[model samples]
Target: MTSPSGAPGPGGPDPRRPSLAWLLLPGLGLLVLAAISVSLGAGDFSFSGLLAGTASESWTLLVASRVPRTLALLLAGMSLAVAGLIMQMLVRNRYVEPSTAGTTESATLGILCLMLLAPDTPVIGKMLAATAFAMAGTLLFLGILRRVPLRSPFLVPLIGLVLGGVVHAVTTFFAYRHDMLQSLYAWTTGDFSGVLRGRYELLWIGFGLACAAYLAADRYTVAGMGQQFTTNLGLNHRRLTLMGLLIVSAIASVVVVTAGNIPFLGLIVPNAVSLVLGDNMRRSVPWVALLGGSFVLACDVLGRLVHPPYEIPIGTVVGIVGSALFLLLILRRKGANA
Candidate 1:
């Protein structure tokens, strides 16, 4: 029932399942992009100068800023993509992700609340608050879905978007009242320009959560089959659902607190990967993480180069690209069903 590559195969081979040779290209691409990410920035960094023992400052800059920013990009991208996959499986909808499902908005709201209530809170405290709020918001979204009589796949993400919009409006209103709208914008928009050594280390926590998701991949795959089916298989559907929410919320909070929201990184990557690899989470996790990191790195590199010594936000770049891809996916699905 399964191929040597770990993909399901009843007849002979699943063409959608990629072989090791096919993976090499993207794996190499990720490495190249990471090298470029470390080498390219606002600051002048010349490898030739470093090799000649003349660019001490360039070396310092590489160590202090470039590496950390690149790491943050990879971590944020991987975490969000995996989180999105988990969400889609748990909700049984391809379109759902943290940004749409009120998770990111709730995390942003939590950060805003922290700034107001305890300005002196540490980074860990902010992460905790955001995670808690994100969990509650995701739960609310699920509760709403349960109450709805019709559960069209298209309707699910739309409901999530509406819920996210409401939470975002509340966050915006509070931020405006406190005269902290600018700060709020900085926290909500994805930008790597400000990332430094100490600031981005929290993203490692997200990386850990992503790994945990991999560990629970089988449970999630069964859960995706629906509650009654999962129950019949001797798994606790509600418990698995809660665990998935916890992982998703925690990853979203960490990314928001560290690199800000990279919208649609989660929504698009998992969907694209699922198209090729099917819903076997264990088989798909590495591909999802690699593609996610590569996409964000490409966006970030373009953001740096689009202007002269200035930068565009990664969020803007990803939003433009992601929206187009999202529309294409919807159209493609409609055609298939038609």
Candidate 2:
């Protein structure tokens, strides 16, 4: 039997113990990557400089660039991954996320509005506008989900993809008409090089919502179980679903404004976690955050080193990796069904 804290007593696996142990692997990964994150960039800096405490530029780089980038990656990765898991649960679809569901695109459009109209809106104002747009987009996506019934699981996400595309096209058309397409392009691709001391602090909101999701984890899972089960359990299904969408929208807006719109991170990380950790949202959510942050940090570092002096965007690297993994997931699902 398992103890109250989930320790295995005699024979079977301890439900919580295994997940706790699995978390350590990512902990070690983050440690190594943390060091690498601070060290690699355009300028030369070393851990020795940090230890010796003599080099002035090293200290400046740590304070000015690497530290901010590392922090941004961690928060953005963790938030997006948790948000992805919540979106999947809320809609009962494994495929739709902030990227695919038009949430980020809507946020981008909002930012465009702020840019064109005010051109001087403060960061907080832009984020507020973007978040409002993102929330609306999420509700619209959920509304579409309810009205349509799909026999095949893939069809739902396919519709989301098309919808997101339409949103993107609209946003792009407006951006072009305003002659701001170049600026909008930057917002759509994920990169951390621009991160600095004051730039990425907004992502802390995403972190806060991630913690909130954990507290409401069981409710989210119950909501995913369906209308009858949720209602029978004396829960407000619509309220819970709304809570989930708000969390997703918050993460999408913050990340898009503070970092950039990263695709497939939400889709890719959760599915991979479920493969190893199983489908218990309460248990697997932490792993989802850890793996997501780790993967993004790893991809960010890879983006820096791949071309040396020149860097590739993290979105490109992540998209390439995520797309390949997505095909594998599709094949695996098909095989299991067969």
Candidate 3:
């Protein structure tokens, strides 16, 4: 149940929920990390130089590439984490995420369609197409849940995993037939090296979606409670469900378009925060956003530095970490149930 403040509180306010103090504490750490990230690669980047504005090359890298990349990380992190939270609430299951629930595959199909039909289309048009496919894909997953007898919570994600596999198969088949398989792989492989000024603007849509989520946080929690419950409380539950779908699909498409299948950011970030902070959507969204951004930013920096001058993809690092966490979560879940 929720506390008087509507935050999840079995007894009282969740201590793990960030206050201004908590925000400041991590905010400072993230700031320090972000500074380091911005200054690391191929430029005369230092605090003094940044402040004095003396280095033109440094300033250009800061403004054109590094700054945009960082912003993309922040937006992708925040949006995808919140998207995971929303999917969990909507399904009332902890395991569903854009990656798991066929959302990514659906969005990728949309992207593939755009590539075939209108390679010259603007990015926004591509985003719209992908968002539409993602919405349909997510809806299909939910439809599966509705039609089947799912007795175990674990079954929810298991089905989602299977669903994602099927979707991926389709994406692969079509991409191969079209002889665009290489382009497809590069597009969705989740690297940030290409995120210069002009390439990454689609991520702004994710930022805007994140803000919308914050505004309607309470509605999500209500919708999560189930259909009859929300309806009795005077909400159109279906409408809100569709709204959640739209938001989830929108952010997923935007992130995929701009950042390229940043695997497990959605799955790992929200689940990690939820373990500490509980399921208080209103209170927890900000924490999710902040910590998710910080985590992705750190991973991006690590990717850049691990090979130095050369680089690993941000998705590769996140995939390695997230896959470990995924196994751990499954084991912990089993132990708890046992």
Candidate 4:
């Protein structure tokens, strides 16, 4: 019962399908969160001073730090959320995301390998290696899923967790041997404190990939209906799947390279959007992106304010919040089934 446009059919506008007006709510919320993110930081900033042409230092700090950090948050959040949505659609599992599927771990492993083999490799080179590894890891995960007899939705993510654990262990072992454990930890821990004007430009690539995902939303929605269905509709499932893998891998790699991993972000944001908008990718992508940005910004702001000058890493804050919500989603699913 979906229209060609991916909306409800036959029945006048479905209440579950958000009107354009309702869609603006999350957009507005993201804007407000962006404002707060720009305003809050360790450094003293005054809007009035800046407007009145008095706070020269404040303007410098705003441009060099706060603005960049906020932009990074938004880009990383939107990219990860879209990446997760695409992963879930391709895998036909609500529980799977880049983190759970070993994509991030594989990317980190690639970066570690680059550090060992050629420490002088530029940032772009590192990103390429990470993307390559992520794609291979994700394809391996899909291969495993095909071979496994179990098709339970929960089992899919559990398998991914197992794969991610193995990849992470490998990455950790190499990092520990080379005394790069601390460096690895820093790269994997999501934080925005270090973001500055020139440092965060790479994240724009990730944002672009996210935009690309939105453009291919209809194809992904078809692919999500299953390979047989997609083929019957005259679409090449394998090509679409490969394109999605590339998008997911590049987005994950770029975000990890730029801002470290924000776990469960891709997982929860899409699920939240799905609950409201159904599985229609076209309708849900914008909401997912907006909510994702707002969620990360809010978490980052909370981390900054919680300990004053000492800020908690965004990864830690998101892990705590996301894990709790993950459990709640599980419980609610079980309760509904019961």
Candidate 5:
């Protein structure tokens, strides 16, 4: 038998040591990117001056805008990735992710509703509404999964795509009718350009949710096993599943609200981490979170640097890069199954 963390059950490698890299490469990469994001912006600044902590308007821009943006990117990226990994594990499928599962779309709809209903609602109130509705959507999907027999692990992803499409259509309908299509566009095409000291506080929700995820890591792994098996081990599978869903919803909503929708982040980062680090949730969690944070920060940096006066949105870079990787995975799976 294998443990949920992808370890050999009884004779597995020592759980005390990380099964993968000597040093967490992904985390190291994230740190490097964070530094770069903090140092570079739309201003003319010397790299040496930044290192020396020189004081200037450019330095202030770097400090105020770029630094907070980098932090938000890291927090949102890590939370979403971890949430996606947990969703896949709980459902026993590799391709299940928050965006595909209709959770993000639902949250977006919630945001749109808030905008329409109470245009002056506080950001926290909007976030709470989004999270609540997003959690409901996740629970609905889980219920649907209970009724449907999964033909293959891959089939579940197809279902999610269809579900997301349906929700997107509904969201679009409301958005277009309310003459808020452009507003919704702004939400879908994520940009870190708006990140500043006061506005970026929403991202802290992701950080707090990540902490909750870490605390529940062991329980989620236990619940990943079949319900009966978990029951035999004296674990409450239902409670764990609900708890995982709550965490997922909170993280997903916060990411969507803060950074717009970043697809495949939840899927690709975790899959890559699992391939290298194995499935041990605890061991994989840190590296996975780091990889996600690093990947998004790098993409955000690319978006900023690639376009000088005008910046590309972070979601665009992620979509382009992540889609390519996702297609490769699909092709590889086809080859193996063929």
Candidate 6:
């Protein structure tokens, strides 16, 4: 996608010298690692004999466990990244993300509700319920944004973060009361270890939502510039607002339902791209897509390598690492403003 004439636009490091070389190198490295990750396993740890449909104990392990896990990691990362980017843009705040806006927590609540209300319901039903709840959360956040005029830049994300905490607390309360805390714990911690064929199909919902996000790229860009700016450009502000909210909700729901709540992914990736490439949602969208995918994949690889026989959940790593980067960005922006 082409970028506007402001700054360097969102192509890459530079507009004239858009060296995707840097991004490409890491991306390619991750791809190689992911392929190896797909082929390697706890039982056998071999990739040589899995070239064809030839069967080995290792090949079976590779196909059944590693491949699906890798795919889930890729999709979850990309979806959450894009979701975060869009949320920041719509709110015109750098720190915003699905987790912050109560979207992810809302989806978790939706899942819990489904488990309680219809224990035997189909996966699709749960997905739909989660999607609806996520959208409701996003809309509620937007309502707050519209109602409270945030003079300080930090207030926006701070409010959303507080809202998320509230939702999370409520969810925790319910889970504890119902004696479903164990299930909630497993759901909240973003791990890709158990991803297999039938189970992993849910992640495709995230991919589809990401696709829908791309299609609404133009509207989101307009909406990000503020309602007045959008209306001036002959765009329907309400429609765009609703559209953006729906996009954010859909992405959040899919991510929560598929891989549990991955914090700061949406907040970090978009802000990273905006700093480097500028906040042209058109261009930043794809960069957010690649960077998000690459970042998550890299983290997943790190998780694998850090613990040889065991694994670290991606959500914990993201929270620990992403929070640091986010703070750095916040401080930098504050310094610049000062």
Q: Mark the regions of model 6 whose C-alpha exceeds 4 Å error after superposition.
A: 1-17, 52-55
TM-score of each model, paired residue for residue:
0.95, 0.93, 0.92, 0.95, 0.91, 0.91
Candidate 6 lDDT, tens digit per residue, 286-314? 77888888888877777777978787888
lDDT per model, in order? Answer: 0.88, 0.84, 0.82, 0.89, 0.79, 0.77
Give a tens-digit lDDT track for model 4, residues 1-338: 33232222223334376688888888888889988888887789988899999999999999999899999999999989999999988888778899999999999999999999999999999999999999999999999989997645678888999999999999999999999999899878998889999999988998899999999999998998878988999999999999999999999999889889899999999988877777888888988889999999999999999988889999999999999999998777666556
Alpha-carbon error at 230 in model 2, in Å?
A: 1.0
- lDDT of candidate 1 at residue 224, scale 0 to 100: 80
Report how far off residue 70 is in candidate 4 (Å): 0.2
Candidate 2 stretches greater than 4 Å from native: 1-21
Better of 1 and 6 by TM-score: 1
lDDT (10s digit) by residue, model 5, range 41-131: 6677666776676657667776677778888898888888999888977876767888778888888888998999999998898898898
| Per-model tally of clashing residue pairs | 0, 0, 0, 0, 2, 1
Q: Against the correct fold, how does model 1 do in TM-score?
A: 0.95
Kindly list the per-residue Cα lDDT of model 3 for residues 143-168, writing each as its tens digit: 99899887777788788889989988
Give lDDT: candidate 1, residue 330.
Answer: 82
**Which residue pairs come into collision in candidate 2?**
none
Q: List, residue by residue over 94-162, the lDDT tens digit for candidate 2.
A: 776788788898899889989999998898898889988998987887788679877677776787887
Error of 6 at 86 (Å): 1.1
Residue 9, model 6: Cα distance from true site in angstroms: 12
- The positional error of residue 324 in candidate 1, measured at the CA in angstroms, is 0.6
In candidate 5, the residue pairs with backbone N, CA or C atoms under 3 Å apart (3 or more residues apart, or in different chains) clash, namely 5-279, 5-280
Error of 4 at 311 (Å): 0.5
lDDT of 1 by residue, 106-179 (tens): 99999999999999999999999999999999999999988986435678888899999999999999999999
Q: List the residue pairs that clash in candidate 4.
A: none
